[model samples]
Every structure is written in structure tokens, then in C-alpha cells.
Target chain A: MANPAYVAVDWGTSSFRLWLIGKDDSILGESRSNEGMTTAAKTGFAEVLASHLAKVNAPENLPVIICGMAGAKQGWIEAGYIDVPASLSSILAGAVAVPGQRRDVRILPGLAQRDQARPDVMRGEETQLLGALGPGSTGSQAVCMPGTHSKWVHVADGRVTAFSSFMTGELFDAISKHTILSHAVAGADQSPADEAAFESAIKAAYEQPAMATNLFFTARSGQLLHGLTAAAAQAKISGTLIGLEIAGAMTNAGSGVSITLVAAGRLQGLYEAAFKALSLSHNTIDADTAVRGGLAAAAKAIWPN
Target chain B: MANPAYVAVDWGTSSFRLWLIGKDDSILGESRSNEGMTTAAKTGFAEVLASHLAKVNAPENLPVIICGMAGAKQGWIEAGYIDVPASLSSILAGAVAVPGQRRDVRILPGLAQRDQARPDVMRGEETQLLGALGPGSTGSQAVCMPGTHSKWVHVADGRVTAFSSFMTGELFDAISKHTILSHAVAGADQSPADEAAFESAIKAAYEQPAMATNLFFTARSGQLLHGLTAAAAQAKISGTLIGLEIAGAMTNAGSGVSITLVAAGRLQGLYEAAFKALSLSHNTIDADTAVRGGLAAAAKAIWPN
Candidate 1:
């Protein structure tokens, strides 16, 4: 068995994942839990980390490298942010040390675009960008990271030129549960997936993004008038939001810019479908691999052999 | 006091308003309560109406004309809908009577655009359109009725050509109370209103409607980086949603289409500000006057002297 060298942790707002990296760069052990920053803030970040470390039988003196919300102002310690346009390598340099710990611990700083007009910030996704594009990546690209707050970062010659966050996923959840559309999508979970409805919505929204809220209303109206199924209604909503987001993201990206999607599971599928429906070609990178790779890059940078 | 001729009630999803109409069509007495369709649905709609009528000292034999959600499927009775392209007079002709009532009680039918691609329905706003544009009105006009589900109807020669429903007001409520923007907008009600921020957001969203969700995120980013006040944050959200709605509403309207705003109080002010910021010329009509006008028309048609 390869000897465990260091621990790589990705602690987000509501989730925690730890990987015990071997000396040869293999994952010797792993742990995951819902005790993310929100939960750890109440239960104690140190205790949470210690328990996860123990679960993986991490060596007491083993160094730990972390990324994501754990380094936020309300996290274990404020790692701060490296304002862009900045080189990906700058994130490694901006890592802040967690004080008074027996073992060395460092959390990677996030990226902030402080444009007065288009101010934006990102945390864990910075590390994912680091892994997805690497520190020395070149050429212009639009990198999309789909989630609760989907992010589209425009990179030029390995530097983040600008990025925008779309409240697509969160809006979907809120609109579905809190709006009248809830009834239109009540039994969606149990119904068959409606790919055609989703594609149609994506095209409609992409073509006429201004009509987004009106298009959302059609979910209920369609059900009332056209007997639109619950699944179709749900699909329409997901597609509309995704389509609106893509339109917004593409506004800043120069024509013919390469598109790379970083996502996994359901989000991965949905975004891919959206891109296809819009006739846009794109590449995909497994989100887990990208984030883990990012944590690894940070780990190696902090503790050079 | 002039003899009471009839009663006009605008019973919405969450509100109830009754006005005693005199023989001269003046408002002789008025009563208002939160006993709208939802509340009255559980607590006997007839009893609720009787109490409000008693408060206004309504005569037992005096007829009543109602509009809005009281005509919905879940309300007192199913008043159904009048499908458009329709004449405004058809709404008056389509009033459904409540059986077994001692006094005449008629609930006006709503308007439904049963387009396969963009199906839409409006319960109360149809009446507002009728009152705003009148039965014999001519020329093309875009009638904007701002509310929880704002309806923008395109009227030509006293006929309802088509309409779109934007979930602006409801979305504003949900997003403000249910999303991350909630934190950004906390204490906004107590803070001084920010007209500059509101106008700026209106212009931004109106110009680039695709960037709406991104603009919404600026509420938080602005506060984090620029120290934007809670009121400004709240204003930004409101402006973005309203701007998006206007942009969408204007799409179906002809280039020279006259804009008529039917709203009252705060909504009127906000929409007026939005229109002014967009440099669009529009005439305003009081919402109360419009619905009452619609109900009066219905009453006159149903019970002639």
C-alpha cells in the first residue's frame, strides 16, 4: 500500500470531502460528509476536521490542504481572495495558514472580480479552474461550472479575464417550490423525463431570453391549457434557466471561443443537453476529478518535495 | 345618501374589496378585507360576501357584479374563461351567475390565450384591460397591468389580440424572501429608497435582458465589494425584474403602440419610474377605477333599468 502523504479537503457551504493522498499521488483513503462550513461552524471546524481525519486514519503530523468556503470569512479562517485578472498560480501563493494547529494546514484563497460595474466572486470553483485548465493553460476559453449558482469564467492566456455568476439553479429551486409553478411540477420526480420539452424551452429562451419570466409562467399555463405533464413542466423550468444563463455567459465571450463545461451527475447531463439544443459544441471535464486535481495542485505547491 | 344601485367586488387570490355603487355610478360605500378567494374558500364565500355587504349597508335585493380570482376553479364558483382573439364585450356576456342566491351574484369570466406555444390566462387583469381600454376603443395599445402576475395585453379595435403574463411581482417576492439576495436586502424596508440604483439597474436590465440573473447576483457582490446599501440592493432586484418584464412585454407590441399603465400606489410609482428610466411615454390609470369600471360595465349589461 502506498503511504499516505497529505490530506486534501474540499469544504463547501453544506458538504465536506476529504482525500488521503499517497506519496505516489494515489488516493489512499477518502471521507465525505454533510458537515460542511455551515455545520462545522456550529459543531466546531477543528472537531469536524479531526473526526474526518481520524476516519481516514490520517497521520497526526500529516499536512492538510483545503479549498472552498472553509476559507471564507465565516469559515475556519479567512484565506482572503486574489483579485483578477490574475494568473491561476497566484491562488497557490495566496493560501493562508490555519494557526495554532499541531499539523500544518493551509486553505487556498478564492478569486474576486472587483469590477465596479460587474463585481463577482468565486471560492471552490477557483480550485476547479486551476485543475481544469491548469496553472499554465493558454488560449481563450469560456469555462462553465454549473451548480446552485452557475459560474461562467472567461479566461485569456491562463488568466481569468472576467466571470459572472447566474442564480439559475437556486432560482429554479425557489421558483419551483415557492411560486405557483409548484403545482405544475408537483409530481415531476415520479414522472418520466421530458427531453423534448427541455430542448424546446432551451431554444425558446436562448432565442428570446428577455421573455424568461413570461416563459416560466408558461409552465403553469401550459398545464392548464395544453395538459403539459408535471415532468415536462419541470423540464421547461430547468431548460429556461439554463438557456437564460448560457445567453448571459456568451455575451462577454468572443465569437468562436472554446467552451468547457465542468460538472458531474444530473447537472452535467442537463447542461450538456442545453448546449446541444442550442447547437453549441462544448467539451466536458468531470467535476470531481477537476476539484480533486485542484486540491492536489494546492497540496503539492504548499509542501514541495 | 343616494340609493344603492349595485355592488362591485374585486375578489383576488388574497384580498377582497367591495364598493357600493349609487344610482349615479358613484361609490356610495366601500369595504375591504383580506378575505380573498383563498381565505373565503375555507370560511364560506357567501358568508364573507354577506358580511362585507352588511358593512356597506347593501340592500338584500341589490345585485352584485364581481371580477378576479373569485371566478377561478377553486373560488366560490367556476366562472371559466373567454378565449381570445375576443371582444371586450364578450367578458360582460360571459358572467356566470351563482345559483340559489337571493340577490343576483355574477362572477366575470377571465381571458385565456390558448396558443399551443405560449398559452396564458388572466383572471382579474382582463377586467382591468376592459376598463382601461373600454368596449368601443380603437387603435393598437399595450395595456400593462402590474401585479403578482403582471399581464400585458395587446388590444386593437376593442378586441383582445393577445397577452403575456410575466411572473415579475411574485418572482420579486419569492427571490427577496427565499434566495441569497434576502440577506442583501435585509433592512431594505427601513432604509431610504435608492432611486439612482434603481434607475441604473433598470437601464442595465432593459438593455441586456439576458444578463438579468447575473444582474441579480450583483446585489450581493455590490454589497460585498462596493458597500451598496440594503435599499439599493433591494432596488436593484426590483428594477431588474421590472425591466425584464418590460423588455419582454414590448417584444409583442408594435413600434408605435401606445402604452397604458393600470396600477395604483406603490406599484404605480415603481412602474412609472421604470418607464421613465426607459424613456417610454405612457398614460397611467388607477387600478381601482379600471376594475370598478369593468364591473360597472358588466352590471349595466346584466341588469338594465
Candidate 2:
């Protein structure tokens, strides 16, 4: 028999990322591509994988542990999800077995909270969240993972009990770029006036949650009455959206549990502002690290003696 | 006021429509453009107006009636909605008297459904619906106005008291192009297959009201197992959204009130299917007639005793 190698994959809507891990759990190489689960079909998935692996010097025959939307119905292979009180070991154990090239390939199941208001679902991220907390992670913790559909995951005693996904980024884009409000929001030209407007907009969203609809008017009224530049008004609009997101998500977390934000780049700055607005204590972690760390923890679980 | 010529403009999110109507209620000429309210503000309102009027052989100082989003907060000028129990005459009376245009301009105020969920607001379309009802429009009636944010309005005694906005069209687009459900749908194309898929989807939404989220999975399953094409699936997705919309908005109409569908072109067909699922009787009015009808009604109100 050939020596077994470890592979970790985070496949999402817009991109595919893979990591080749050694026997001792060190990442030998990692790769990513724009060919997300949505764009790539079953046949195209192979090419995307090969293209990504070629960049990172990874062997094709390595055993792979997959997570995220890759296993979704549209994904390469539909890796379904498990339910609440989900254990890291239980999920790793329930891995949907998929055929691979001379390697034991497995897809991690996502988690669904059917009892919630929206019956929210999480795929690759839940496993990554689990992997971040490690094999024996216990107690109540709130994890904020922000993106187009930002998720607030509640992990209780090494199990994911519930989570909610907010369409913050998508809503912001639609309302800003697609609706009448788009008239007020200018693009990413660096301006001091724009930054201040953005901050003020955020403040508005946080202050009067019910008044979101009303505040949108101020974007133009601000320009009309007070001579707010379009860019500045745009920022105010952006702030209102992010602020509402923070206010809405924070209610569930309460002030009790510890909060960890799993984000990267631009989203990190927004999360920092949101957390501060809600008066919640928070620690930040890189998006990739959480995924890698979560995968490492999952590795410990399936291999735990 | 040399010869006092008149005009009517219907402005929306994506398109601008204008009709040169005489005082005796005759359409002398009409004009349209992709230059909607959102785009024109950047280049100044007067420039866009002149550009549109350039197509018409009318004098610059013609009296103009404007509607739709052009009167929105971010629009050309902020026009307030006249509350319910208020006649079209009352609303025309409340129209923001923007002093001296390149023409004499009167922006028809939109309608406001107060103290409800999100404080519902409608502009140009409401007046269009009123126009469709005609100058002699009296008593109770329901109108289905379809677009990105489709609105179902119920009018009693010539006043709009209750109406609901459904993001059905936008939801269809979002689920088709953005959500995990994207794989379930293909782009819009062709007709026969669209009809079959759409009918089935409307039925599904009608039958299972609570299982909207669950039902989406069938898009992929239907395609994979039942050989549903991407375009067919797309049509079904649209059908489901509109069906859900009808189910929600048509609850109060029952058999008591008359249903007037104020849609033009492609949407009237979709609205028909939506009604079919609910087994409801309705009348369809096309865009041009509806616009002309609406304009004539508004013109009456502007010159009302």
C-alpha cells in the first residue's frame, strides 16, 4: 500500500481552495482558483482541481478531506450536512465517501439549524469552525464569519447547536448598486470626506434599527440640505448596512459568550467597528487560519485513538 | 404660457417613459430612454430632461406631469405621498410645485401606506394604476404591479389604503444567480419548456406554502432526475416566486374585489400563471394602454373641479 497523504479543501460559491498536508499535519502547499462551485460542473471540477494542484506542487493521489459548498448539490460531489449538537468526530465520521485517484477521499458534512427563525444552513464553514476549536472544544462561543452571507455560529460544548446567516454583503450591493439608493453611493476613490460619511452612516444604522428605511432618504437629503458629496453619502449608506448587521447579529450572542471573528482583509475592519458598536469583546482570526486550524482539529478527531 | 402644451413622465429604476398628452387627453407623441432617475442626477436633471424632450416636437415650456421613482428621495425632487382616503386630485394637489422648469413641471406625489411593516411607499406606479382605473375610477379594486419589487395594491373608494411589496422578481434572480440554489436554475430562454416548468412551480408554491426553502432543492433534483432543463428550471424558479407572491397578496381580495393586473409584455403572462395556481379570476391590462389610461386619469385630476 502507498503512504497516505492528507488534503484539505474549502470549496465555496466563488472559489476553490485546497491544502496538501503532511502526515505530521504541516501544510506542504496550498492553492486557490476562481472556478468556484457555482461556475464549475462535475467535469470542470477535475480541471479546476488539477489547475490548482499544479500551482501548489501537490500530488494527485493524496487522500482529501473536503468541506464547504463543494459537496453541495451543485458542488463537485454533494456532501450533505449533519444536525445540531454536532460533534467534530461525528461529522468527520459521517464524511460522505467519494471516489478518488488512488486515495481515500472524504467530504465533510455541513450543519443545519432547522429550529431557528429561518432554518439556517452552513456547509464547509461549520466544519472549519469545528476544526478551529479543535477536537475537544467545549463551552458556549459565538463565531462571526462575514461574507456575502455572513454567519453567526453558536458552538456549545464541542457541538454546533445553531447558526444564522445574514445576506449583508449581497443586500448592501443590491441596495447600493441596483436600487435608487445607488445614486448616492460613489465608488472606491479614496477620499477623507467619503470615510467620514461611511462612519456617520454606520452610526445611523446602529442608533435607530427600525429607522433603516428612513435613513436611506438622508443619503440624498444630506446631499441636498448639507451638501454631502456623493462619495460621503455612499459611505453613510455602507455604514447603515454594516451597523444593522452588527446590531441584528449581536442580539443573539448577548453579552455572555466570548466572540471570535473569522474574517480577512476588508471585512475585518467592518467587523471591528460592528463589535465595538455592540459593546462586545471580540478576538480576530484570519479566515484561512480558521479553516486550516479547523481542518487540523478534524484530522485529530478522525485519527484520535 | 404660449399655448400651454402638457406632458406626462413615468420614471423608474431602470427606464424613463414620457408621453406628450394634450389638455383634451390625446397622446400627441411619446418618448422613452434608458436614462432613468438614478442615472440622470449625476449629469444634472435639466440636461437629461432636455435630452428626452429633444425627441419630441414640443415647446420647452410645456406643462409636465412626472411619476414613479423620479419623485423618490434620491430622485429629481423629493415629492411626498398623499395618504389613503386621498383622491388622485388630492395627490395632484399635493404634487411638489417645483418652480419654473425648462417647462412648467408638476411631479405627481407617490402613495404612502403608513404605520405598517417597513412603512410601505409607492410612487409612479400607483398613479399608473389609478390611471388604468380611468378618470371615472371609483369603488374598490386590486391591482398587481409587477417588476423587481412587485406591489399588490388594494384601493377602496379611489384611495389606496393597503398594499404589499413582494421582492419576488429580485428573489428569483438572487436564488437563480447568487444563492446555493443557483444550480437549480438556468438562464431565461425559449417558451414551451418555460410554460411547463412555470406551471409546475406555481403549483408547488401554492401547495406547500411553508416549505419554500425545502422546495428549492427540487430544482436540482427535478433536473437531475426528471430531465428539467436549466431554462425550464429558471422559469420554475420565477414561477415559484410569483406564486408565493400571489399567495401572499391575494389573500384579502378573495371573490369580493376585482383583480386588475397592471403589467406590460412578458410579466402579464407570469401574472396569469400565478393567478392560475390560486384559481383566481383576473383582468390583464398591457403597458401602453395602462400608461395611457393612467396618464389620462392623472390629467383629469390635474384639471379636476
Candidate 3:
């Protein structure tokens, strides 16, 4: 195996992923855990990193590049933010080094849209955007990075003009586990998904985003009146949220704006299904790849070989 | 005091309210508790009723007329539902009697809009509608009953034409307590409300209802970037939900439709603020009076003494 060149970490609110990269720009080893910023904050961040680095058998002198909530004020160290409208490469200059560490560990800054009327922020997605679309990429694009807090970025050329975060995924989790709809979706995850119900919900919510809340109610009502299954009920909740997100994202992007969906695993499948249901054409980029690409860019810029 | 004529109870999912009515239609005594449908279902609805009846010192022969989730499938008795395009008075004909009760006791049926595409059901609000608009009221009117699940009823010439239920209050609660915005609204309820923030959010949501979810995120982002107060964050959440509800309610009800706001206390204050912010003219009716009025009409219709 090629000797490890550097370590790249994507530390989110509830998940932690570390990748050991080779000198030839290939992944040499990987480490994954639930000890994200939330957990790491409780159990020392340095201790968590040390354990993960040991697991991956990374070199003692390897430098590290970090992104996501690890850069939050509440995270490992306050990396702060790069406010828009800023060039994608501007983020590279804002990386903050963690003091008192032997290894040259650095955390990348996030992006913040500070318009008083529509203030928004993203902790780790700036790297994903950088990875999906290179620092010097051209053209106007609508990029969607879906997760607990799904972000939609509108880019004009290489500059991120504006972005909005929708509390879709988090709301879904909260509603499914805490609300009356929880009863409607009991055991839904154990069963096969109801794609038909999902598509119908996506279309309805996208067309009438104003009725998003009412649409969520139908998850229970549909089960009461139409004998809808638990799977279908869950699908309705998920679809309504995603559809509302798509509608909000499309509002200022004008007609037929090219969509670049940056997602992975289950979320990617759901968004693709949503786009297909709405007859929307879009390109897909692996979120893991994008984040890794972003971390690699930051690493190369910080330590040119 | 005059002998108790009838007992009125507005039993909901989480609350129970009882009023002992005298022969002259005056409230002889009253009782309130948290033993609503959920608690009643577990501890026994008959026992819960007996405790409340004892507290109010009702006459042994006094008949009870109940409305709300007490008549739900999971309640004391299944009162079923009055399907819409139903007349305001149609609810009276569907009351189901509790078989084992010593005193004459009946629970009013709810309303169900079975449009498969937009299925909806209400257990308690139908009576509020009947009470607020009356069985013989004339002309078109839009009634907004704000609650955990806010109901918007479109009544035309005393007949219930259509309605929609927005998950406004519930969403506000869930978002405030369960989401990241919870931090932003920690001391909101204890502090004086920030009306300006509430009005600003309401206007923004009303203008772009599609951006409802995005608007919710601003609650947290605003706090992070703009030093927003806890009261302001709570107000923003409240205003967004209410504003989205108003927008959805108005979509089908043409321009300048007269609104009747049926609410009580804090909810009444919040909604009144919302209407004022939007510059929408509306008449207000106390929710207590509306539910009582509805039960009275039902009592008179059932027992024409």
C-alpha cells in the first residue's frame, strides 16, 4: 500500500468519518463512528481523534484536515465562517489551525448568508460544494445537499450567491418519533417503502407548498379513511418534507435551472425519486466523494508537495 | 341555585373541561382537568367523567352532552363522523350515547372531509364552528380556529362547504422543544413576546408560503448571526406557522374574504397579532363561548323541552 499522505475527517453533529489518503491521492484506510461533534464534545475531541487515528494506523506525523460541526463554536475549535457572496476558493483561506496540537490539524470554515431578511448558515456543506464544483467551475447551478438540515445553494459561476437550509430531515425525525403521525408510521421502516404514496405526496406538496402542514396531517387521515399502510404513511411524511424543500429551492432559481444533487445512500435515492416524480432532470454527485474531494483540496492548498 | 339542567364537556386529546348548566341556561358550576382522551382511555373515561361531575356538584339526573376526542375511536365511545359538505346542524344527528353510563350521556360526532386526495378529520372543532357561525347563519364566511392543529373552515350559507387543518401549533411546539431552534427559544415563554419579530416572520411567510421550512431555519440562523433574542426566536416560529396557515387558508377563499377568528387567551393574542400584521380584517369570538354555544345548540336540538 502507498504510504499515507494525510488524514481527512468529516465530523458532523451526530456522525464521524475519517479517511486516510495515500500519496497518490487514493484512499488507504477508513474509520467511521457515531462519536461526532456532539459526542466528541463530551468525550474530548483530541481523544476521539487519537482513537480513530490509531484504528486507521495513520502515521504519527500526518497532518489532518477537518470539516463540518467540528469547526462550530461548540465543536473542537471555533473555525468561524466565510460569509457570501464569496468565491468558493475563499473558504480555503479561512481554515483555522487547532492550537496546542503537535500535528498540524486544521478545521475548514463554513459559509454564512448574513442578509438580515433571510439569514442562513451551513457548517460542513461548504467543503461539499467545493468538492462537487471545483473552485474555478463556471455556470449557474442549484446544488442540493440533503441531510438533517438540507441545504440548497444557488451558485452563479464559481461564487455562491445565496443558499437556504430547510429543516426537512430533522422535522421528519422529530415528527415521526414525537408527533401523532408516529402512530401512523409505526413499523414503517421494517416494511418495504410505498413509492406510489411518496410520488403522490411529492407532487401534491410541490404544487401546493402552502399546504405542507395540512399534507402532513393526511399521513394519519389517509390511514383512517383510506386504510393506508404504515409504510405509506411514513412515505407521505417524508415526501411532503422533500417536496416542500424542492419547491422552496426552486422559487428563486428561475425555470429549468440545472440541479446538481449532492447526496449519498438513502437520501440520494429519495431525492432522485422526488426529482423523477416531479419530471425534473438533475445530475447526481456522491456526497462522500464531494466531501473527500473538498478535504483533499484544502489539504493540497495547505501543504503543496 | 336553580337545579342543574344539563352538563357540557369539551373533552380533547389532552384536556378535559366540564360545565354544569342550570335550567335557566346559566353555568351553575365548572370543572377542568388534564384527564382528556389519552388519560381517560387508560384510567377509564367513565371514572374520569364521574370525578369531574363530582367536582362540579352536578344534579344526579343532569344529562351530559360531550364533544371532542372523548367521542373518538379511542375514547369513551365512538361517536363516528359527519362527512362534509355537511350542514352545521348535521352534527347533532350523529351523537352516540354511552351505553353503561348511569345518567343520560351523549358524545357528538366529528366532521370528516373524505376527499381521498386531501383526507381530513376533526373531533372537537365542528362544535366550535356550529357555535361560532350558528346553524342558521347566512352569507359566506371563513372561520380560523387556531390550536395544536388549526382548523380553517369555509362555510357558505350555514352549510359547511370545505375545510383544511394546518399543523401550526403542534409544529411550533415540536420545533421549539425538539429542534436546534430550541436553544434559540429557551426563555421565550417566560419573557414578554417580541411582537416585531413575530410580525416580520408572518409577513415573510405570507408573501412566500413555499419558503415556510426555510423561514423556520432562520430562527436558529438569526440567533447565530444576528444576536436574536429567545423571545424573538419563539415569535418567529409562531408567526411562520400562523402565516403559512393563513396563506393556505386564503388560497381557495378568493381576495378579501371576511375571517372569523375563534380562539382563547394566548392563542387569541398571537392570532390577533398575526391578522393585524397582515392588515387583514377579522372578527374575534371567545373559544369558550363558541364551544359552549355549540353544545347548547346540540342540547336544545336533541331535547326540545
Candidate 4:
């Protein structure tokens, strides 16, 4: 194998992950750290990155393939978003050949939708979508990445079509901890929407004619004088909010259409649950391997011998 | 003149106020502190009263009449609540006389509709309602005490006919500070409601087919992509929430009835503006003298000789 020469880094707003591989697509070494795009500015990126290579026993001269928010304007190097109706090669707006570096570094460009209607923008996830689709992976598909600012990406014919972001996690945290429901909830860290309370709250939120603003007070007042349990209050808030999230995302992704859930770990289950709750058919795209697949594809295109 | 007759104490959830009056209904002295029912332990009532007395210059002996949350089950002395079909005088379920006290220390009973059809209860504010409807006061009127735990009391024939609590302020704070709209608003002090935004949001909330949950996310998405201002977002939240509050309160307070907007300050003005924005008719009731009116009424009731 030719001197295990390339690396892939998926750096984002709040996280930084790195992977190293050789010519034959075999893993040579891997390193993932917490010094994401946000913190790297305060602590020099080069210094943190230098220490990362030293610990991993990987040479500093390894050609690096980077995707995600690392190319953000606030990131280490600004790799802007690629406009719509553009391919991976021609759409590489943020990808830059970093000069004066010992190893070749090519950053992947994020996607942007300048459609006068919606006009939403997203970064980092496009490359993953590209990888999920594979070299031959093409045609229209909706990709749902569950997160704090969850994104629903529409891709087809080898390019990003549109995207929309939802502040689901932040909303869940707010309603649960800051709202009147806070008085109703006994504790946090409760989970699994399959619970009786969770199911009940979801059903109530979905079926009740009352608005959320109207129903919210019932959580606290119901507990105060009417005796609603804290756990049940929490479940009501979670169910109501997650139900709203599903509705919002479905509006963005279009109903009764085929969509792919690009999520991994616990988040994968949540997206699946939301889809199931909403009765939407979706195929799960392994988030972990999708990035690796994209990086592998990028290596083939850029470092081809 | 009879010996003072009685001291009337309006001891609420978060506050304590006392009046020492003679049989002729003249105020010899008065005192107040933050030893509210919620903050004080069950055994600390006597001490709180004593501490307030120590700070005031008073006559040798005077009968003391206490009302509000001080009579709650968890209060220093549990005066308990009188059942419905309750008259002001009938509200005197049983006055708890303090042990070894020089004079009568009657802690008045609150009203309870608990375990009833609506299952609601009121700890304090009964005295305020009675005092407002005292012989010296005018015809049947509605008194609105807006706060974290706001109460709207209806007074008729010198009695509190009905009342309802609106969790408006808490809901507003929760939705604004904790929800998706937080992104749109950087930070804002309590200002008069933005009329344009308020009117629009209220209209949207009332007219929209779906509930508050369906409407809230737009506050952020509208701003991020649609360019809605932070202040506008805040107003949108306030309008949507206040509309819901009005809707909720209306459920209890039957419609087409005359509304008394007991407003005195800027905050009151904001509420009035919101009410007016919705084309609702209201007569302003000055809150400045509402408490004093309550105080005077209690003194006269016990001083009759």
C-alpha cells in the first residue's frame, strides 16, 4: 500500500472528528477530539491539530479531506457554501487547497439554497449526503439529520435541491425547563416515547382542540391544584414539542414521499420514531459510514493515481 | 370608642401586610414585610407577626384579623377555605384565635371549589374582593390583579361571586426566553407591546386553524430567512400568548360582558393595549387605591360597635 497517505476530518460548529486511511481504503489510524470549530479559534487550530497527529502516531504530511463547519466563515479556514444546480466538483465553493502546508488539504463545500422561497442554507451535511448516495447514488431523496438544529435536506440528480432547519432540541429544553411545565416535571433524563405517559401526551397534543399556549398552563395548574405528576407533565411537554417538530419537518420534506433518515446513535432512533409517529416511510442512512464513504469517494477523485 | 377593635392582615403567598385600627375605624399604626405564607414555615406565623409589630409603633392592645394565604393549610395557622355559595360574612368559616394573645387574632378563611366540577381553589385575595365590595364601594365590579399568579375577581352584592386565575406573565416569560423565538430576540426589557406585531400575532393566533404550537416556530424561521426583527418576534410571542390567555380566561368569564381593566402602571397599559388591539371593551380600574380600599373595608367591618 502506497504510504498510507490521506485523512478525513468532519469538523462542525460544536464538534471535531478526524479519520485517517491509506491508498487501499484500509484504516491506518483515527483521531476524534472535542476541539470543535468554535473552541479552535480561542486555542490555535494548528497547535491543537499538531498535538492530535503526535498522539495518533500519524505523520503530519498526510493529505487531509475535511467537511462540515470547519469551512465556515468563523471556522479555521472559510470554505463557503456551494450554490444550487451545481455538482460536487463545480459546486466546490468552500473547498480550498491550503498552501504552505506539508500535506495536501482539500476541504469540502457545504450546501446552500438561495431559492427566493424558503431560502434556507446548510453546511457539512451535503458531503455526507453525497457519500450516502455513493458515486452512483443519485435521484431525489430527502435526508433527515436529527439534532439541536435538525436539517432536512432534499437532494436529487447529484446535487442539493433544498433544505430547512428546525430548532427542536432547543425548544424541547426550553418548554421542559423554563416553562410552567417546569413546576410539573419532577426530573429530567426520562426517555423512550413508548411509555404510557408519553403516548398519552402525544395523543392529547395531536388530538386536543386546544392550542399549545392554551394547553401549557394546564400542565402547571393541573399539577398545582389538580394533581398532575411531574413525570407526566414532562412527557406531555416532550410529546407536544416532538409532535410539532414532526409536523414542521414533514411540511419541509413533503408528505407521502420517500425520505432517508441520515442519523446515527440515539438520534437515529429518534428520527425513526418521529417518522413512525407521523406515519412517514423513511430509509435509515448510516450517518457514521456515510461520512466515511464520502471521504473515500473524495480520496478517489482527488488522489487518483 | 371600643378598643380597636381588630387588626386586619392581608397575608398573601409572597407578602404580609397589617393594619392596627381602633373601634372607630381609625388607623393607629400599620406594618408590612415579606413573610408570605409560601416563605414562612408552618410554625413561624407568630414570629413573623411579632417581627412586623416590633418594627411598628402600636397601641397596647388591638384585635387582629388575618386573611389570604396566611390561612392556607400550609400557612402559619391553617384557617382553611369556606365552601361555595360563600358570602363575605359567611366566609368567616372559623377564625383561628392565637394562643396567649392579648386580643382576637382572627385568620380569615379562603374559598375552595376543590374536588368540585371545575376543581379550583383560592387561598388569598378573598379579603381584597370583599373589601373592594364594602359598603363604601360602588356597584358590582370586576377586579383584575395581574402578576405571576394573576387573579380576576368578580364582585357583586358585596360578595365575590366568581374568580379565575390566568397564568399569563409566567407563560409569556417562558415562551419568549426559552423557545425558538429566543434566536430572534437578543434581549428586551419589559416595554409596551409592539402594536403592529401584537395585532398581527393576535389575529394570526385567533384566526389560525391550528393552535399556538403550529404558530410559534414561524417566529424563528420567519426571522432567520424572512428577516423578522427581534422586537417583532417578542411581540409575536406576546400577542399569540395573550390571545390564548384571553381565550382561556373567556372560557371561564362568559363573553359580551363588561370588562373592567384595573390598570394603573405601564404594564397595565400594555395589557390594556393588547385588549384594545383585539377590539375588546374595558373600563380601567385604578389599582393604586384597590389595596388601600381593601384595607379600609376590612378595618370598618371589625370596628362596628
Scored on chain A only, each candidate's TM-score is: 0.98, 0.88, 0.98, 0.85
Predicted complexes: DockQ each: 0.89, 0.07, 0.83, 0.19
* Model 3 spans with C-alpha error above 4 angstroms: A190-192, B190-192
Candidate 4 A-chain TM? 0.85
Task: Please report the interface RMSD of model 1 to 1 decimal.
Answer: 0.6
Candidate 1's residue-wise lDDT over B1-305, tens digit each? 88999999999999999999999999999999999999999999999999999999999999999999999989999999999999999999999999999999999999999999999999988888788778999988999999899999998899999999999999998999999999999988832299998999999998899999999999998988889889999999999999999998887785578999999989999999999999899999999999999988989999989
**Model 4 residue B266 CA deviation in Å:** 4.2
TM-score of 1: 0.99
**lDDT (tens digit, per residue) of candidate 2 on B106-153:** 777787655421245677776777667754568788888888777778
| lDDT of the candidates, in the order given | 0.92, 0.67, 0.92, 0.64
Residue lDDT tens for model 4, A1-305: 44676787787777877776777777777777888887887897666666667666677667788888777666777777677756655433446775566778777777665554234555677777777776454667777776766777766766666666656566667667775466567564556433555554555444432334434545565565667667666666666555555655555556766788888976676556655665678799898788877877776688777
Evaluated at residue A5, the lDDT of candidate 2 is 57
Q: Which 10 successive residues of model 2 chain B have the least lDDT summed?
A: B208-217
Docking class of 1: high
TM-score (all chains, Cα) for each model: 0.99, 0.61, 0.98, 0.70
Clashing pairs in 1: none
Candidate 2, which segments miss by more than 4 Å at Cα?
A1-305, B1-5, B22-24, B116-118, B180-187, B190-193, B224-227, B252-255, B301-305
Off by over 4 Å in 1: A190-192, B190-192
Comparing 1 and 2 on lDDT, the stronger one = 1
Give the least accurate 10-residue stretch of model 3 chain A, judged by summed lDDT: A186-195
